[model samples]
Target chain A: MKITIIGSGNAATVLAKLCVQQGHSIVQIISRNEEKGKNLAQNFNAQYIPLNGTVNKNIEIVLVAITDSVFPKALDGLNFGSIPVFHTGGAVSMNVLRNTTTNYGVLYPLQSLSAEVEEIPTIPFLIEANSENSFKILNEFANTLSNNVTKVLEFKRLRLHAAAAIANNFTNYLYTCAKTYCDNEELDFNLLKPLILETANRIQNNDPEKVQTGPAKRQDVYTLGKHLQLFSEYPKLRTLYTRMTESIMHG
Target chain B: MKITIIGSGNAATVLAKLCVQQGHSIVQIISRNEEKGKNLAQNFNAQYIPLNGTVNKNIEIVLVAITDSVFPKALDGLNFGSIPVFHTGGAVSMNVLRNTTTNYGVLYPLQSLSAEVEEIPTIPFLIEANSENSFKILNEFANTLSNNVTKVLEFKRLRLHAAAAIANNFTNYLYTCAKTYCDNEELDFNLLKPLILETANRIQNNDPEKVQTGPAKRQDVYTLGKHLQLFSEYPKLRTLYTRMTESIMHG
Candidate 1:
């Protein structure tokens, strides 16, 4: 499939890489950011088109990977016609693409992507299409990029996106919190790596609730008091700690 | 080394297995629960002694893997005056073992353990001892069990344990929270696994703050509002969501 990747951001960069890697031709890179657009297009020697410019006629698909706030209006003035279009915002609705073209859907790659990451991780694509034929096309395309692709409904995709935030973003914040605490206490944060890895590994096979072990879970009052006493200066962590503890204990 | 394992619980089972795998001879298994003690002892054909029974004279070390609340008093009547005594409670102080034996320390394995887990993962042991000789002995013994071993001071060990609780225990709770939300929303929890694994893997090479990407970090008010709106019925999740969002945004 010939793709015109719109927007020169992390998602665009990663998806374009995967697309090119799978032997899909990137016909054009379309973006208002001329420098980034041209830089990304240089990799495939593809034409660089401005956002308002006419999308390449030969392109089979236009991937608009932009922020959630800019959706619907992001493709408002531009015309895609009957060409299949896929946007990659997790929170954005597939209906947002309805007005753009007769064949449009979402191809949300469910992972935290970054332009600077040397090696892109495996991406699980959540796909939704306007029709069964479009779904088949998108599903085949996504399969070229990743083995873990699922045809998700609109509402279910929204739920998955929210759950991804909780599982990935919130959990990373917890790691950051722990790292910060270790740094402040002059303890080596590196020591926590094995434990962190093990914790992550345990969840692969068992429910997190089943593997939970801590002072809070067992209601160890003395240890909890000691841990809490160390958090007098870290008011934010203290609050989060107390809330998590109570939730685990009483739940 | 000839060793006596005290208690017949998760930690006891795991450490005993590691000891046996490393070719150490079990002098005895002592616990108030005779059935569990005997069951564990049968693997090595070691004697199962009552809690009040004497520690085997030939045993070089006694591993008292008991609850923090039962510590100090748990071995009140038992005598192991000259032998090296090591306990496995993370929060319990090295000082707690001082009265039972002249040579005492802590061997805090910084990972969650369970009797049911089929394959025990790599463990990092944080050790502390009363004297230089005991430190050397404990370090050498720990090296037999795990490749990653560190001699952490008492205060730092406590801090490490607290940090482990944050990174592992708190993180696991977040996973459980997402899973529950997915279950109630009729979304497949397995779909979130890739995101979760990627989130965990990212922290291995980069700082969690550096790799942090989410609505809260980016200050996307629309998506945050949508996520919070979804959590309205879940008061606990809503509270955690808001707290985490604010923490990421402000700090």
Candidate 2:
């Protein structure tokens, strides 16, 4: 499969590398930044094109891998002929591409991608398309890179993105709060690493609610009070601590 | 070293087994329930004693490995005859055992332990003692089990516990909330597991604040609003979602 990836961000970089590794040909790499675009194109042996430049006519797949808000502008004037164009976004609907191309779809990968990770972990591709034929083609293309591919509609994909935000993004915020408290108290945040990893690992084989442990889960009021008191100096953390504890115990 | 464990709970079981693995003798296992006490005692080749029964006089270390509330009652009216009594609690202070024995310390292992885990993960032991002699003795005994032992004071331990509550407990609750949302939407929660594991693994080497990714972290107001609109039917999750999103974006 010959593909053209639009954008030179994290998502573009990850998808470009993975697609190349899966025996796919990268025909074009487009970005507003010339340096990043040239670098990514060089890595995949593809032609580097500026944002408004024309894409390769022979490319089978065109992937718009920019942020959700910047997505429309990035593909505003690009014409991919009859080729299937897909945007990699969790919350952006497939209709966003209606004006740009008739053969548009969504190829959202439901995993946080990082440049530093040497191996690409199992990425669940949540796909959507403008038509049945486009859907089948996107599914087949997704299967080439990952075994975990599913056709998810826009509304359901939005909900899944919400859940992912809570599970991944918000959880990392809590980690930041934990690290902040540790720094303030002159404690080593590394001490909490084992517990964090174990908690994540346990949920892989068991339900998270059933495996939950802590003062709130066990309803240890004294310890909860102590924890709240410990966060008295940081109002934001204290509020989060109290509300999350209440949610766990009573919600 | 001769040790007497004063409970049959998860912490007590893990500590007793780890101590036995380190070639230390478990002199006695005391609990209100005879079956559990006897079972744990048999596993370590130690005597099973009732809660009110006398412990072995030759025991050098007495580990009061019970819940924080029951800790004081377990040590009340019991004499260790100059043996160092240590309570394995994070928020608990060393002064709790001041009246029970002349030699008292804390052996708080800062990790969540479970019966299902066959091998003990790396557990950080936070140690505190009332005197220099007790501190050295407790340090020596802790060294036998783990190399990640540190002499932590009471206030620091309490704060560490609070941080841990967020990093582990509150994080797990977020997962529960995410799972609940996924179940309600007829989506497979398994799709989020790889992201969860990757987020935790990334933070092991990088600071969490730098690696945060989501709609809120990216300050995508449209996507954030869409996520909040999805949770409107579930009031508790809606509130948590709004507040946590705001906290992440602003706080």
Candidate 3:
């Protein structure tokens, strides 16, 4: 299958490399920045196109991997003829490309990706299309890259996007907050790593509710009050701590 | 080493199994509940003693793995004599046992334990003692069960405990919240498993801040507002959604 990648971000570069490794032909790589476009295109021996130039219609699939804010603007200028175009966005809908082409879909890789790090290929892909034929094409395309692929509708995908925020994004923020607190107090954060790993592994076999343990969960009000007093300096953290504890206790 | 476990909870069971596996002699397994004490004692081929009975003073080490609320009451009744007793608690200081016995210490396993689940041997134990001799003994004892053992002070251990809450307990709560939301909505929570596992694995290799994503990090107010609106039925969840998003955006 001949593929043309749009954008040169982490997702675009990763997808390009994976597609090439899977024996799919990457005909072209497009990016607003010449250096980024050249970098990815050179890796796959594909043509590099600037944003101002027209897209090559010979490519079977066009994957737009640009930032969500720029997705609309990028689609406004894209002319892929009748070729199917898919955007790798969790929040954005498949209908965003409705005016651009008849065959449009979504190819959302449900993992936080980074260009500097090696990609983990086992992450699931959430795919959606405007029509059954387009869904089939996009599904096949994703199936070639990953064994874990789901054809989720827009509403369910939105719910998943929200859940992902709570589970992944918000959880990581909590870790960052903890690290910040430790660093400020000149403490070692490494001691918490074992507990972190164990907590994550527990959910593989048991519900988190059954495994919950902490001062708040135990309703140790004295210790909770002490922790709350310590959080006076970090009002936002204090609020979060209080609210989360209350939720866990009552839920 | 001659050991006497003072409780028959998850921590007690895990520590007893590990000690028995290491070929150490468990002198007795004591519990407030006679049945639980007998069951745990049978596993290690040790004697089972009810709380009303006296503990044998010949034991070198006595580990109290009871709940925080019962620690004071339990310690008041136990006779440590010249035996070194340690409580397996992260937040509680060694001073909690100061009035109960002259020889007291702490041996906290920084992992969430479950009686039904098989224990992982590679857990980190935070050891503390009121005196140098007690510290040495606790260190030597922890060495037999786990390779990752550190002598931590009360303040540092408290910080570590708080950090563990963020990384382990709090993270698990997030997973629970997400699972509940998915279940209530009739969505397949299994689809999020890959995302959850990858999120945990990513922190092993990189700083969480650098790999952060989702609506809050991306500042996608539109999608966030939609989510909050969707969560209107769940007041607690809606509040959590708003608070977490605000923290991430502002912090």
Candidate 4:
């Protein structure tokens, strides 16, 4: 497919590279900044477009892989003609691009994409479209890049995004809390890696409830009190620990 | 090394199997229950002793892989003569076996072991000893089973256990929360596998703080408020969401 990506950020760069590697022609690369636009465009051997520009009419798809806040404004003056327009955002709804063109949808890659990181091939992409024809086009487009593409509605995708926040974002915060605590105590954070890996691997076969273990889960109030007391030096961490433990024990 | 395994629980089973695979002679298998003792003992072709029976003095090392609560009481009656005794526990202090024997130590595998789960070859074992000679013996014993073994002190091991609780136990709870939420909403929990795997893999190279993302970390009050309201049915989950969001925002 002849594709045009409407962003030059991490997600845009990574997706562009992957699409190019998959033998898709990137017709144009769009960005507000000319330099970033040119950089990505040069990599994919596509045309670079600044703000207040239009996508190629011949391109099969126009992927609006930009920030949520700027997406609507960025598409205000742009025209994709008959090409399908899609945004690569989890939280943002597909309707955000409804006004941009008749053929609009969402092409969200459900993974943390960073330019510095190696590309992951099997990320589940949640595709949504305003119409059946557009849905097929987006679905087929996603199929070429990944095997794990699912056509989900906007509401279901939103719920999935919320759950992702809990599992990915909130869990990462717990890791950050652990790392901070370890750093302050002059402990080796690397020692926690095996535990992290094991916990994750356990849930692959067993339910998380069945595999749960700790002071809170075991109801070991003495160790819990000790852990809470130790957290007094870090007030924010103490609050988090207290709240989390209380939720686990009482809830 | 001639080794005798005490208790036939998950840790003991895994350790016994690993030892047997390493061509070590398992002199005997001891458990409070005769059935489990016999079952484990049969695997390694070693003698199975009932709780009322005597210890095998022929064994050079006795590994007391049992629960934390009964560890002290169990050690009180055991008579291993001059044999080196070691307990596999993280939070239990080395002093628990002080009066029982002079040659005592700790050999804590820093992974969540289960009898049903297939054994992993490279588990990080935390070794601690009451004396230099005991430590040397435990070190040599650990090197035979796993390549990654650390001679950690009791105090440091305690801190590492706390870190493990955060990274493993707390993180698993978050996963449970996500799964529960997904099930309640009739969404496929399998969709979360990629996100979970990626989150774990990212920590291999980047710090959790640097890779952290979501509405909470971004301080998007609107999305956080929406999520909290959506979680009103699950009061405990709601509290957790609110508290975690506050921690990430302030931290």
Winner by DockQ:
1
For model 2, how does the per-residue alpha-carbon lDDT over A30-87 read when each residue is reduced to its tens digit? 8998999999999988999997776667878989888886757767777776688899
Candidate 2 regions with alpha-carbon error over 4 angstroms: A33-39, A42-45, A71-73, A99-102, A116-119, B33-39, B42-46, B116-119
Tens digit of lDDT per residue, candidate 4, span B14-83? 8988888888988899899789989999988899988768777887888988876565787667776657
For each predicted model, how many residue pairs clash, with residues at least 3 apart or on different chains? 0, 0, 0, 0
For residues B22-79, could you state the per-residue lDDT of candidate 1 as single tens digits? Answer: 8998879999888999998997778999888766778898899987778888887776
Evaluated on CA atoms against the true complex, candidate 2 attains a DockQ of: 0.69
Candidate with the greatest TM-score versus the true structure: 1
Q: Per-candidate DockQ versus the true complex?
A: 0.77, 0.69, 0.64, 0.60
Candidate 1's TM-score on the B chain: 0.92
Model 1 chain A: lowest-lDDT 10 consecutive positions: A69-78
Q: Rate the local accuracy (lDDT) of all candidates.
A: 0.86, 0.87, 0.81, 0.82
Cα lDDT tens digits for candidate 4, A1-251: 88888899878988998888889989898899789889999988899988777556787888888865564777777766667888998878788787778898998888767665675635789998988999888888899999899888877887887888888888888889899889988888887787787777778777888778777986877677767766778887777777777777876
Worst 10 residues of 2 chain A by lDDT: A113-122
The CA lDDT at B185 in model 4 is: 92
Model 3's CAPRI class? medium
Question: What's the distance in Å from true for residue B150, model 3?
Answer: 1.1
